[model samples]
Target chain A: MKFKTFAMFVGPSVFLMLLFIAFPLVSVLLNSFQVTQPVFTTQEVETCSAGFLTQNCVTEVKTIPVLDENGDTVTTTEWVGFSSYANVLGGQRFVDAITSFDLGALLRIDFWRALRFTLTFTLITLPLVLGLGLAIAVVVNNATKAIKGPVIFVSLLPFIITPVIGGLSIRWLFYGDGIVTVWLEALFNTDLSIAANGWAIEFLMMFYRVWHVAPFAFVIFYAGLQTVNQDTLESAVIDGASRWERLRYVVIPHLMPLIVFITLIHLMDAYRAFEEVIAFSSESYRITLQYLTYDYLTPDDAGNRAISSASASAMLTMVGVVILLAAPLRRTWQEHRGR
Target chain B: MSDASLPRAMRQPLSLKLASNAFLLVWLLLAAFPLVWILAMSFKSPVDAFSSSAWEVLTGPRTLSDGNGVSIVDIVLGIALAWLAIKAATKLLMPMTVAEGTLHRIFNWAVVALGFGTLFVIGFFFFLPLVAAPLEGLLGPLGQPILGITTEHYQAVWVENAFYENFRNSLIVTVGVVTVSLTVGTLAGYGLARSGSTLAFWILIIALVFRALPHSVLVAGYLPVFINSAEILSPILGENAPTLYGQPLAVIAVLVSINQPFTIWMLRSFFQNIPVDLDESARVDGCTHFQAFRWVIMPVMWPGVITTGLFSFLLAYNDFLVTSLLLDASNQTMVPAIAGYFNRETTTTDQVEAVAAAVSITAPLFLLVMIFQRQIVSGLTAGAVKG
Candidate 1:
């Protein structure tokens, strides 16, 4: 195709990406290194009628760069290098906490707290989501055909709801005197509030993440299951291989690429976990990197936002995500090239 | 223990089957029960839903209520029973072949009608009343407890909270996101398919990077532009131009960009698979480039386009991140607005209404899946595995 034809086809996307994605991307990098605040400048003015009585009556009145607040002159946006990053990432505080070896003190910082949970949530749920998805897919594939459609439909319902609503539903089930809690207490003959304890809350969130995301992997794997070479399966059966051996030797290898694909998608998504934190109301005890960025942007008293810090945090989160993505992406690229 | 088995119990080793059943059962509960529970809870009165009686809402019996100072219960039940009895009589004759004679065919049709009619009668009089009216009796309509059902919370959410406005906002924003993403992404996908330029290849790769980048990082970037949109546009539109911030248009713009990577990924191969000779021949026949594309390529691209469009619609429809952050109160979509009902600042009494709102927000999603389940299942792995 001619470049002009290409432009007609590709130009709009480039312009959109440039305007929306690329521009914001560059802005984030820039904002990470800068800060904006109300600008002000000092001006000298003569006292009302004192100038008539006394020569040389000059008093300083704070004048705003654009607008004044409470008669105090506010300044325009100013560039500050790395200060916002330091505040959010806890430059000195992080180092001090590390050297002192105090886990509680380290987690006392919002960024650290969020980072800890984000990492734990991602790493822990990755295996569970993959394992559960693969298990269900393989079993369903193995099951009698009559029950498959209903099973798939029911299994997919959790993922069908958006994560927030899914999280909320689970949250209510674990909330004060909730049915689940009520049953547990009744069965165990002891009182317990799953939502009240940090560990319990984290476990529930992890479980919810797995429940909501596993069906996606299951769909991918189930689709993959159909493509498994029946000829190879027959050979394995002739070799007197058990089901476990067939799965271990034959099925897994075929599904390897799909497993990687699911992992990549899950890693990218899990690293940015936000909706669960909001849905479960877990911010006080647990937060994720994405929610930390939101917390920064949430307007504080007097309507001042932590935009600068949010910018720094966003860029930092992107850097972390890119690192996580690099390996799987490279593998995909290599696999694509081979194909 | 040997492969031959120590006994009949151990003959073939039932462990995997047992394990599979247990595993499947656990996931079924994990995956399906919460939504079912929520649906069950949404119908209960706010008092019963949150109170210790919450469990009763599911197990308790229900009954039809009086209407306009008169009970229509007896009439409805009489009709339902008659239909059901006819259906039961037909069940015994279900094995009869319709091809045998007119009598058999009539019996078959009667069975079908009675079966369906019984269901409709029971649902209309018993279930619909529970969802749409006030109820009071010794036994609530369906032979359940007197306080088994209520429609007040659904009313509080739909009518009192004006959720329809939020629904309208979601529709507007989702439509915009779908349209813009499809249009621009399809164009770019076509380009990528035909060009084979190293530049185009790199662009696709770069877009994948953007795709994986979380929305918050991007939200941080968009904040400045939105806050200063009016300032930026004053010189261009000559003043009084509405800022893009807080507009459904802005949310759509961001969503379209955010969803483009996947769209391009989906459509590019579809575009490439089209016989290039068709486009070439059309061009050779003196068709303009754009004309050839419009006349030739688009007609053949409908299936892929439809698949891509459904996904785009879903991306915009299901998104909570960009919409939650970018849109102001009046601009909030259904997902965010549903969450807004549960904002910590809201009172405890609104909890039932919040759940009702969740049910309302999710009802369309549930319906969409039921209607288009095949398309969605196929679309989920559209990019993951190459055909």
Candidate 2:
């Protein structure tokens, strides 16, 4: 209980967190303003040739920089202030598209496209995760033990698999000539590929999100179910409340705080949509900011990486995520202070 | 739909009950069918597994079974089997006194009859095709037919894909993560529980915030250090020092850091439930605080620690992005390996091996879940229920 004892107890965890998490956060911020590239040089040399060509002369060994002194093509990292951010913003092209009011052109910017998907993914999945999870929890709570164990196990399957694998499983079901897709086409007497259109792909992504995460909500709500005041439930039963009314009045209110906790976790997670996009192979019709950062880091044909751009986008993404999480975060902080 | 005849206290409508059951059954299928199908596909021949229709997987070269009709005798026997199985299972599973009156017996009989009919249809249609095909394949020369199953896919995936190596890497990283997170997190959680200082409370709140920070965001932070390890780590250990990138140890460290916050939150509450008197008594008897924790506290807290450890294992095991990005290609984890299965060998890929690889990846986790379902669920819901 003493300060020294507490420090001795807690120091290792804090040290790990700071070294791995806090330090990297600061490093990312610093790296966003700096750039790195492969070093290149231009030079000439002199050589002697055979008698057929009399003599072949080359320039002396005078190394030349790949770019002018002030340009960005240098091999070394440079502190370029917000230039990386501006470049990521697509400065001239984005500004022109915006001024001209071309919606298609506006979305053509990789950052904007990724941001759009990320925002939609986060906002839309929030309510569904809460609602569906609550529904499953309520239903499962009333189930017999024999049924309950298997049902819980089944529900946790999606949540237990790795995110990328979960997405891939869902994608495989509707992939090219996949069983469900072909069966649907045969039954309905029409051909429609879920992966062929943007909206359809988005739909699958959204559906996958709900399936993958609702179990998390269900588990939390199921725990919350155990904490509901039994005396209050008994009193409500004596008052002849219907099941639905009991749920609305007694259960929902009891689980409100847990709901908020789940919402906070979901928002932060959903905003960083990387795995699903990759698993779904949605790069053609869709992308998320997280994937966009990875895209920047991917080596180009010439083997150069866009690390500064990736860092800038990562910063922008953090800004958006923070903004999205701010309200729930503040509420939690206030509750802690009150406690 | 009218329900007044059911009794005044139990006025629930038949329609509502039917609809609820139907909806829940549909949801159960949605949750379970994918895993079952994947399991089936994993055992199928490559020809059937990759066929445009999943039906072909079971319909291999064999003729179909005769049309089976349900008769009075078959129904009666089915109901008998269902009743016996349920009765025996209940006797083994619980100590409750089962109803045995004439009326209760009649009701149980009716329920078992319904269950029997359902099980019979499912077994005849789904399980029959699944099992017979495999049986026929292995014993076709003895007047049997095609089983449509093969071990070749699993063999190819295991031997050719370097799956064993990646699987080993995953095991090492996940185990390391669980050990590290539990050690530090339990101590920190106990410190918070015992200290009850405002500082400790605020630290928990901060940990929750970090828990909300997206992992991909954290991966972004780690990239520069990992990629520039020699430059960054040289001064700390002085030249030719070990670096973080391409090391399973680095992945394990990051995973532990990511998972520690949740571990502390879960264990702190569990530790709080232990009476402070126990620790005080140990201290009064001339034991140090550390000794009190190790001796007095730990024995009572094994369940909570195991629960936290299971969750930490899940976090490390289920992760892909952090492992894939930080570890070298040769040292990748299973989940990422499965995700990249096609791309890594697009030219040489037999396609059937994908499902085989997927099955292998899920096999360990499947066993883990089967063994610790209760602990995993409890760990997940810890601390969230209370206000």
Candidate 3:
């Protein structure tokens, strides 16, 4: 009776998720293998052929041999093997797209450059965000109510503002007519253009990303800090441990699981950096996989489907690798918690 | 602890407490600087704002140059005389402290009064330019008449001058996406929680991992599928493919895919908190599983449902990337719409208008947060701490 009741309770939800979320994903996976059918009709094809051969023949081709209701087709053809997968892997359009980018001498220089930029951006921002977030969390956690209430709200304000607003505000700060530019020009008695250089652009990008994402890390870390037993910290302090010593011996070890969780989450998010970068810079600095994918799938491009699929495939492979590496960390984490 | 043993305020070792306060102050300044600067800038005239010296900009210049190469200095001298008069008046009226008996209580009251007074004065000064300029423009004989008291900048948004259609489109898309994603997410979350097993646990983890995948990758993967199938699905949709592309459904579909994982995970956590004993008791009372869930668990999980709904709503409303990518040019969200206002060729009025639009776009989210601030903070912190 209990088993029957349990099944009934869980049934609808399980069924709906499988149908909508899981099914569409699986369908995409399957469709990626199959060559998509061309939308053009037989008469359209015959008219093109007739233009080359004989003009009068185009009119006679009204009922030009075409696919019937069943699978029989005199004109329409379906190719169904590993052809779709093979075409993607062959790097035909992929090679052309990479070579067209013309970054430097290397054959896949664009892809490599994007990869390099993404990794550096992630590395630079992740530590700063986590460090600042942890510090803010600890401070806010210990503050008096008078200070804490307002401080908590202010700390969390950036997270509430959409990234577009955050990015626009930063852009305004650095623009030629902006306050920062005006202030800098006056202070130094010289013109400075941070946007013109690659390093500065990447730095600004990282700063904006960190500004928007740090609040997330702060909230998570704050919550994790709350879970740490006060007794452990008190005991450590009574034993004559310094603040840094207590942090190292007690808090760090306790927050390790959460740190790992947030790091992995942020790493994945950073890799997919799209909107902020797009808003910050023009095409010259568009060197991320997400931008590459956007460039490929843009409506004007005819070969969008193939190149975008290849890029998506590349992203999936990278994510798979990250997950594989984190597997052991996750295992040890679960084991530690179990103990 | 002895009073002598206790560290004196002046001689106390530079403790973490002191360092933390300093650190938090710096961070708070960093966070608040742009907001305060922009608010100040909104009040300053364009010429004064572009001035080279911060001292001159913060305090009006001692002398002014007209574009015609004329100088004006008496205005500065008159302002200085007025400042002296005001200072003398303040010194005469303001008391140092109240008397010491019941006057001690009066001293505290005086301090509070002074603090509030200072805030009121500063706020009035900050907003005075924004208020006075428009009024002066309207009242002047030669100047073009304007209707509003504040800057005409906000007219673009209030009137929906540029992207009014886009604003409506965003609202429709946000509402549709939130409604669908929350409904599906809630059900999926309940399922995962009730059917607890190793496989169920693994699936939950997979959902979370999928949620963690970069939004761009998911969009990339989903685009080919959505675009190609649009024509095929058009008949079912009762519209043409292009018509559907920028419509609310497209945004809703993408949001549903992206947000389902979060909805499920949050719901599962909420469900797990419900005791198995309740389910067993329901079964013993001859209620079917569906009836037990509907009658028992659903009421208890209402808060979780609402929290999930609000989160999904905010995600949909605030999203810029997916909406920008999938939605058509005509179907811009508020974020993108306001962004477009700034990207336009800026006139003095237009620039102000852009700032107004930005403030308007963010105002709703701010109001929502203020109203449900407690629920949201708890909901956000719950996932991190409990999960």
| Candidate achieving the largest lDDT | 1
* DockQ, structure candidate 1: 0.47
Q: Candidate 1 overall Cα lDDT vs. reference?
A: 0.79
Against the true structure, candidate 2 reaches a TM-score of 0.84
Residues B314-357, candidate 3, lDDT per residue (tens digit)?
Answer: 78877876777677676677776765666683665555566566
> Comparing candidate 1 with candidate 2, which one achieves the higher lDDT?
1
The 10 consecutive residues of candidate 1 chain A with the worst lDDT sum are A66-75
* lDDT of candidate 1 over B177-226, digit per residue (tens): 87888899888888898887667878888888888888888888897789
Question: How do the predictions measure up, each by TM-score?
Answer: 0.83, 0.84, 0.73
Task: Put down candidate 2 lDDT per residue, A1-339, tens digits, no spaces.
Answer: 799999999999988888877787787788889876646775776676665646665557766657757684556778899988988887888999989998788788888988888888889999999998998887777655588888888888888877776777777678776677888899999988788889989988998899889999999998898778877887787898988888899999999889878987788788877888877889999999888887776657985567778778888887886677678668877987898
Candidate 3 Cα outliers beyond 4 Å, as residue runs:
A1-109, A185-190, A301-339, B1-15, B36-150, B160-164, B221-225, B228-230, B234-243, B342-352
Clashes of each: 16, 2, 0
DockQ, every prediction: 0.47, 0.45, 0.29
- The digit string of per-residue lDDT tens for model 1 on A1-339 reads 777778778998888888889999888888888877776666766564435666765576767465555665454566788788889978888889999998888898999898899999999999999999999998888666798888888877787787889999998777876778887887899989787799999998998999999999999999999988887887887898887798899999999989888988898889989989889888888999999998887778977778889998998888797788778679757976775
State residue B211's C-alpha deviation in candidate 1, in Å: 0.4
Off by over 4 Å in 2: A45-75, A230-241, A301-303, A336-339, B1-11, B62-143, B344-349
Looking at model 2, give its docking quality level: acceptable
Q: Go through the candidates in order and give each one's C-alpha lDDT.
A: 0.79, 0.77, 0.63
